[model samples]
Target: MLFLDDSKAAHLFFNRLMESLPDHVYFKDREGRFLCVNRAHALYLGLRSPSEAVGRTDYDFFEPAQAKQKDADEREILRSGVGFIEKEERANSIKGVERWVMTTKLPLFGDDGEMIGTFGISRNISEMKQAREALNAHHRLLSTLIDILPCRIVVKDREGRIKLTNRTYRTALGLAEEDSVLGRKLSELSSDGRTQRYAEDDRAVLEQGASILNREDYDASPLGDKRWLLLSKVPLRDASGRVEGVVGMAADITAQKESEARAVEAQRALEEKNRQIESELQIARELQTELMASSMQSVQAELAAGSPFLPRLAFHYEPSAHLAGDFFQFVPVSQKSFALVMCDVMGHGVKAALVTTLVRGLVANIRVDDTSPAQTLHALNERLCALLDRPPLPRFVTAVHALFDTEAGVVRMASAGHPWPLLEREGEGAAPVSELECGPALGLIRGAVYRDIEFSVARGDRLLVFTDGWTEEADDDGEEFGIQRLAEALRRCRAENPYTTLDDLATALRGHAPGRTLADDVCAVLAAF
Candidate 1:
């Protein structure tokens, strides 16, 4: 090696070693100025040489706003003299290209143990993130949302003890709200024929991955009450496909069962009152609207006021002539989380609207805080399929369920034969993030499974969740306003104020249709988080 001064030799020795490493190495002074950089760091920052990056700050190599956070992180390390073991961060290069990096920073001290600067190493993990994204796209698992569902959902372990239960199940069993009556086996609920039957079905599910669909049974409660239950049970499997537990869902049909026995005698009276039923239907429609509007008023008001829990909210719903088969609502999962629910029952008119009514009632009751979107949709599917089978109507329902965590800035979404949502980020420079998967419509096939995908949503990001009516509405020329136009419209509005997002979409959608009246029901919600 060439001869040099002690300090210069020390610098040279460290530089040579660090430069040989593939990861970026950097040194920052207490004031956040770059003291030294390795070859990898220089290349990453687009510097001609390590010397060229000396004394420069991250602002010189990144956007000023982005640099502020990095500066804060380094300053905090210097002030606290504590090391950041490993922090994975998302960032953009000087060229404004986005990537992921795993960074480690430690306090640099002199021989006397006096803190001098910060020594950091950052490894580009963009390739790893890309591979993970691809894998998530193909093989996504929607875990259990069974806990927060409004229905009487129960999960039994291999030993037949209850592993989990939803609120509805506890209430139905006459348990107190604060009671955690877990490990209660099916046989413990009652010593009747129904419990014996359920035990056999649970065994079948665990042994053979069997699925029992819409099996009606009488629940003889220990409280000395009898109720009709439409129960469905399915096997739970591990990654290796080994059956581990069995999940059971129940729908109460006590009222319907009671009404059926009176239907025959009331048929003659109903025949005489057929002409007056139209007025009654109108009253029912008005009542439904009033109920929905009342239920959603508080949340809508809070979101409009720019509450911390709900940054922004906008919605538009248009029901086609003859009936209202479209329904959408917001359910609060907790103090800081909420769910946007959108559903459309197929084949318009009284029957379809009635189905929507049923769907809305179930949604209003479900607690989404402890559930996954996939689990929520599965519970809905099981209930709707069983309920609709009573008359076997010529219709199905499509829906999208999304849970938003305000504090953490995360979104979990699942769809039931619904269209994928459109996303618009904060700034114009940010491109729209869209596309995932849409599962089958509910009530179509027995025991159909749906999956969920999760993504990070920023504070100012806007999500457009709509029904097919919004995208499939045809113009006078018979051309539908497709996804491309919708995306372009969302992009165009990204530069505008967040408050203008819903109006922009509504106007754009209406203009595309070229008529005062829509041919189909349309339900849309624009949520800014």
Candidate 2:
């Protein structure tokens, strides 16, 4: 071999280095025609050697658009006389897929210092380009999902500074674009007294590297509107599984809170009403028991007196509820004459009790000196009708009045649409004594007339005065304890002692239907002469 000069040897070494590079190297003339190509460029072009790629333009293998772009790049490099780098560009290859390449081109000059050609080096960067594109698409999808979510979402860095917030969070806080809430600490953005507490809680979550789910009441808006929010915060971790930051979400629950409060208030009101009703019922029951005891005591005391001609009296009183509208009284009109009254209002409970009390007061205060039974009833109806005409008028009541003169041995009775009185003799069957068809009920029609019927009372004759409550009481199966039943019950007990007979009658009526409650007030008075 002949010895070569240093310059020639260096030129040979540079050509070998270019061919060995893991890239395509080429030189193009000013008109963009290839002048020379390295071994790598020739291999990439599907040529066995550089001689096949030399002396060809890019138009020989590239599409028109690709050729034009390459020519423009070469012209730019030639005109600039400086190296130019392109991070990524597309290159057509003999294979099915296009290749992504990073290219650097420098201007080449002749010995005259005039630009001659462009020297280019290209490296394949397809994988890196695909990865960067995928990353960008993922970021765009994540941002869209956060913006459209219903709940407020926020992201904070490890330092407790806000990094990102969703659309819902910004809208709820009424923040403007000029307000840079990002990179700000929660305590700095929240001006309320509770902000410091929230910051402390966030610190705890970070230190513990755990999640926090809590229900909190906050007044965050400038208008100070209270709202309930369910907050959930989770720690975010880095690739090393170390806690990096926290992501939080808050959902508003103001409407649900208000509804629960209303429900609680309604329950309290219902409980209070029930308590009032129960208390009233208790008081009414006690009053009714006391009234019955007083009436019995008066009858017993009158019996103890030395009045041989006095009529023996007995009573049975029961109520459907704690209070009743049925009442009965015996007044000693004189030593020889006595008056008896029974009254029943239209309804029961507090309303009926009020009318029954009014009737009781009227009968106690009214003077009926030698007055006939019909006249006394007429007077009572007029008084009751007048009372009903005032504000808060009463409904109506059925009443019966009777007067007996032991000296004359005569009994007179009248009714205001009340059930007729029953009369029983020692050897005769019980019969209704007063007329069945009578005047309207008391307080129904003012100045209404009443009819009186009189009969002689023989020795050992019994007169029974009662309100319709006794006949109207219902059994478990809804059958009434009717007038016929009461008459039969009396006939069975007629021969018994008057006091014992009354007690037995009351017990029999209550026991008529076992396990069944009484459904009305009952009052029965028995007078024996």
Candidate 3:
């Protein structure tokens, strides 16, 4: 360093240095009166020259309160031989403009080593203070934003130490106080060691720089309540694209998993119940078949021993479902006279099968020899109406009852909303007995009547009485095998044996049906006189 040799030159250098400085610099006596001030300090006090502020105190320019506080601070510094270094305080210009200043004050000493006064410097820091406050406010807002999210969020460093966690994650950890888990590893927070598994995942993200998304895991709460969690972890990287840590999020899906489990259990239970119902239906179908077959055998034995004019009686019965709605009854009016009742109840399956059972019981009670064919149908209708009248939907049956008097050589027939039978004469081809007056179906009216039509039958003549399932058989074009078609089919199957004729007729009707399948229950009775 070079030294100034002349005193005047040293004095000039000092004054120039003070004038060029932007900060306020001043020297105050022990009584807190200004002895000399730099140009910036004089200008701040509203003085045109530094000489004007030589003997003035802070009270001359500043408010009394501010000046008093400054005097007290300087006195303390002087008495303790200490100094204030970059202490922040409020400063007001002579024009009453408020500013923030960073100040340093020291106790000054003379060349003789005795305490002389205090010299201090101050710099404005108002803009820097405002910027710092704004940054702090933004940080608080961001913290509050993440805290309100429902998803549990956590951030960990490469060392597996927790760096940040939101409110939801803290609650999962059983932490009531905020940010207490920071700087601690997850394994340290719990003794169950389940957190160690989570640490393994975090390590993968930090080491391999790969993300794990939507990983479902079973978790237990601190109180040991079982739950399922869906976790997602992403590697947090630095500016250089190197993995630095991990950011993990989790969602509690316990309710959804439990609901799915319950649904699966319910579905399994329903399937088992359906199987039980199917087994019961199969049993019912077998029982119905046995009952019908037993009745047919008994009637055939009676006819084989008692009557010779009525040579052959054959029937073809089929149902579209496991259970049938069509059934027939043969009541022996006498050794030489018998009546055939063929019925088709509305619908198929279990409900219609039940109705057929009711009809069979009703027919068993009627006296076929005493009542005419029309009178028998009237009785059946009244009984059905009385039994099945009150319902959301109406149940009904279409029936055709025919009395064959082999001794008298005549057949009496009546219809109740049923198709009239086809009469195949010995010489003439087959034709529907359309002369019968058809009445309403049974169970529809309380006192409906039907008129009987009588016609003579010679030996080798055949009578075919069938339900609508035969006449209503449809082809692919929706054309029904109507009464005329059924008459034609019967004529085409005119064999000497009634059983052979019925089998051939059934084959012809099935050929007309689509896919050789019947869409409804079928019942037909053929008698050769």
Candidate 4:
């Protein structure tokens, strides 16, 4: 028999050593009964002491099938008389939570050289298994992100062979699944010089260990169309600081480039139109200056000798545009009788200016025997209708014709779609004069009836004739300089001379309007008796 004393001491020492181990340790007999258990094993099994587990079979603490498997493993270890290792195995805790473990079983022998039991140790591998699962999940997520990205992505190895490409990259190149482009270089796919250049650029970035971004004006598409793209290339490096590959992303900018092109064309067209309008306005200004000079000369020559009965007429005329369509005329019918007429054509600029010139010529040649205001208007209407008979001709003029008989102090007036004239008596307030509106706008209808209306004019009385331009002008705020404002402005300046009164009225009208540019031409004639 073996010496029981030293054997018992050796067993106690081995058990004490196993009790200090970090992992769980136990010994099972060939019958699968727990012969001994260490502190770690008791703690793992939720036993108060090793004595509670001694002499108990694995089936006493574990399920029957699991206990049978353990019993078989222990018998195998004892029979083999060698150590065996299980890299990974499932274990159940006392609370029934499953865990992964790395386990080792060593056969134990008695002094007689016969296997008695198996010594087993187990290490928890649950954390390592979980880490591997997490890494696999992360890789799957990264692959999904690459496939779903809107931009084209590509990865190339140091040899310029394509290692990976995203969905957009394949779509952009019109690649087929059987093409096997993953290991092919860009030059193999596209032999064009432009593709070669892009590969060279990517290689340079990899060599320099630098990134390129937003390199514009680079051809990116394989198609012959002139398309643009924004390209970015980043060098991928290994742990040793060596360039391994390049990751590139390209975004198509064809639409943005087309928009820029269209904007340039629009800008050119707008500039050309502005130049044409400016040229037309300059020519119109020169013609208006010449017309004003000639009209003033004619007026001075006609009034060379002071007339006995003609009123002393001084006037002021201002145009908001290059050319004005407001016309004024004074014709002497007799030694003591004169007719004063004012007309405003429909609009401003060259067209309206030409219409005013026609009115001037008609009034200058009108016969003095025409004593009726209605008759003069009838003759003027026929002349305008004949002149404006062509296609796209302007066909409207608002007019007031007055026959002033100085000897009788009578003013016979007639209007055709014109603003009413203001009359200011010497000691009375200003009011609109009564006149007959007997006709439509001139050139609108031929043979329209016009009637003359008579009003008496005495000394220190005034008759003011004006165009709708004065009362219908718009400000920046879109409000009109209405008739009420015009009347108020005229009444305020009634005491001034004909020229001074009209000047003050025009100035006030301009000041009241917020915008610097006038919306229409303004014209006014002040006749003081």
Candidate 5:
């Protein structure tokens, strides 16, 4: 009905079909001039009507380069009698707008089968092209991101076929750039035992849909070099939450494993060394106890036998560690007098115990005629200063020396950076004897002079000498049991026996300490006059 037998009706139908199409339809003569054009083609050339572009060519409407390419292509189609089908090309319009179009060009034939001109149709494909280009760019960016990472990464399908891999993964398998690994199974790439094991693991993950995290394994490189690796594999799921693949990551942990092994060995050796030192310290502790007890007991016995007035000396020694830094020695200097020396070296343990040993040796060389407390400390300081002169940091000792003359009823005491003694008279309260002057700690300055303070003591009076540990014990609140508290505790003791009095004072100190345990070495001596 559209092409009823009349030539006018056929012409009208052809024009309507051409104008209704969204694509540009055009025809050109042998000379490359537009013979006819549809409405869409006319509008693309910036023409008001189809007739307006009848005598024009692409050169009048497009850039020189595009026009030239179009002319060359149409001429080739005309000569070869072959059509260019669905070829994508860039089109630049007169309005300076660029578009990508898929075009089909055909050589037109007349009724006599002779080539007359070229006819073409072009469809816009700019949006589709742009979308495809953006997708390719994203793929490149993702590939670069994974390739730059140091960890080996791999992605595989549920069938155990490799879908993606990073550069490190390829290099670890000694794969060259030209090698194609995608879509290949692990066994196909390498038939080694480890590769087979990896295939099994992939199957297990796919079946169970579980994640295997940080599994340490011993492995070998392509070159047979041993290595340690921490590997993790997790099931990659789809939008519907079904496991479809696996993402695997592996990190080289050989260095860390080796370091841990070395640390374990070092710890074992250190524990053994500690046990050996502990055994030696036990022996030294026994020897120290025997030597100190024998020296003190002999002096006490000698004084009791020689002097008309018998004096009582009682002491309590408690070492916080296996060995103590606190030491005391009693020397009988005359028929009616004795010298008592007490010392506390800086810290407790082997070093302090060694210093105490050296002090004991120096005390043994003291002459029996020298009863001056200050002179004895001066002599000890000079020897210690010479002996401990070389050190990164110097060691020090606090000391108190006293000469007790029972017949004269006097105690002459001198201190070298030690705590002041506490004095308690019969029927009077106890207090620190702070009036006694103090000198620098021993092992500091050579020839450091010490001065003695003479205090009278009658019958039924008592004097107490102690280390800082007794006054520096702290409770849970970090408050120290200071010298005042110590004096208060001493005043509360009403026992007549000197030993009982010392025990009561120690109990008070233990009660004030955290966990009822002392944190430092403590030494205390009570002299009952």
Candidate 6:
């Protein structure tokens, strides 16, 4: 900066002043020939020293195209007598390496108020160029990744204009490129309802600097196709804590919504099926009840006056479920003879109750007038085997058939694999009558036969025929209320009517099996003579 104008020291000082500066410094004549150069400028041109670059024109060192451009700039500056400051230039150096330079050129004077040449200084900015290029490359990569994302992404300015859009967003609108949609208002692409909603959301994020997250939307196209979307918006902020704009993203949730709708439909179908099943069960229960009532009425009647038989007939019936396997009836053969038949099918439910009906039909077909107890049972058994063996799964029934001959004062009784009937005489104790196991249970063996035994009966003697469901009941302690307990119960009911004796038996079984539900159907036919 030492300037002693019009002195030899001034020329010498100026010559050596900028030699050590790292920037390229040189003075060139109007013809673009180098008049002087610093050591740094000589090194940049790949010269041994300033002496190598001095007096050389630009064409001698630079490419022809670059030399022509520079010659044009120098002539322009010389004609206008103006200077260029901080201009950026890009070119290959004398060493053949491309670089950028920040350059300043000014008109040089001869100290006589006349322009002599151009004074220039250039600073190599290659490192800055490399950094800026790297930043640009990263921005391009980020933009590519955003465009390829599966979710629809878009950016809107503070005025709700579409500033940017990704590939998915444009494709959703059936557009091939975002160029046609960018810088347009949202109302141009969607309905008023959608645009108003978008405007509200944009205001929240861009103006209020808020975030709208996980907002769901529903839409239907003209074809009646429905869709679901999840959207989120956040404010883009500058370093000064000011809102720059808003960034919005939306994800399609149509599949998830459809799956939920299908699940709801399946649940509704299941509920309807359950209702159908319940209705069928109720119908079955009502039909079974009607059948049982009809069975009772067919056998229920008071004997005529002046007859030898009892004046009162009583019975007890209870089913473990809606349908029962146990059934009984009274058949009046003649004025002086009658039969009480009680049967127990193997299991309880619609299947077993169906078997009981079959047993009833077979018993009604028997010729009880001329046949004995054994012969009547034999006829019922053969018919049941024929009917039951026809089904895929077989079933069986155990029964007791008792015929009272009032005129002869004797009882002819037989059994088919069933528990013995109880007889309580006026003077004797109650006991299960011993009879031979003459035949297998009905429906188990074809052509099975039964046997009868006759015993004298007094005028006031009581008879009880019942199914095994009464004797085999169990208490919480797992002990059975066996036939012995039933016999004892019958003995206690000797003073009451025949019907009261059956009730006492049921009450005794419940006492023994306290707090227990009925495990099987119970039935009894009681008569006094």
TM-score of 2: 0.53
lDDT of 5 by residue, 1-529 (tens): 1222368878887889778988998888888888888898788788899889887889999999999999999889888999889999999886798999999999977667889888899998899889888989999999899999888889999888889999888888778662488998777777667776787778889999988899998874433458888989999999999999999998888999999999999999999998998898888887767776776787787674645345677888888888988988888776677888899988887778888988888878876246477888888899999887767323888999988776777788889999989988888988876665699899999879898888888777778999999999999888999988888888888788988989998898988863666888999888887
Q: Scored by CA lDDT, what does every candidate get? A: 0.76, 0.77, 0.83, 0.75, 0.84, 0.78
**Stretches of model 1 off by over 4 angstroms after superposition:** 1-288, 300-309, 390-394, 428-434, 494-500
Instruction: Give the TM-score of each candidate.
Output: 0.44, 0.53, 0.64, 0.55, 0.83, 0.52
- Winner by lDDT between candidate 6 and candidate 2: 6
The regions of model 5 sitting more than 4 angstroms off are 1-55, 84-134, 178-180, 194-196, 220-225, 238-241, 285-291, 306-309, 320-323, 365-371, 386-395, 445-447, 495-500, 516-519
**Could you give me the TM-score of model 6 versus the true structure?**
0.52
Which prediction has more favorable TM-score, 1 or 3? 3
> What TM-score does candidate 5 reach?
0.83
Candidate 2 local lDDT, 91-170, one digit each (tens)? 88535347899998999776677898888889988888899889989988998998889788888888988889888887
Candidate 4 residue spans exceeding 4 A from truth = 1-138, 155-164, 173-192, 195-211, 222-226, 234-246, 266-508, 511-515, 518-529
Give, for candidate 4, the lowest lDDT window spanning 10 residues: 303-312
Ten contiguous residues with the weakest lDDT in model 5 = 1-10
Top candidate (lDDT): 5
Residue pairs in candidate 3 whose N, alpha carbon or C atoms collide under 3 angstroms: none
* Models ranked on TM-score: 5, 3, 4, 2, 6, 1
TM-score of candidate 1 versus the correct structure, residues matched by position? 0.44
Worst 10 residues of 1 by lDDT: 139-148
Please write out the lDDT profile of model 6 over residues 213-321, one tens digit for every residue: 9987787221123668788899977799889888988888989888989999999999999799668766776665565555445544433346555435677788887
| lDDT of residue 116 for candidate 1 | 82
- For model 3, how does the per-residue alpha-carbon lDDT over 1-529 read when each residue is reduced to its tens digit? 1122358788788789789998999888899888878898788888999888877899898877888889999999889888889999988755796888899999988767777778899887889878878988998897898899887888888998888889888898789765579899877788876776777888888888899999887864533458888889999998999888999988888998999999999999998997998898889887876776666666666664645466478888888887888888887766677788889989898888888899999998898789998999999999999887767333899998888876777788889999888888987888877764699999998889789988888888888888999888888888988888788878788787777888888888888864766888888888787
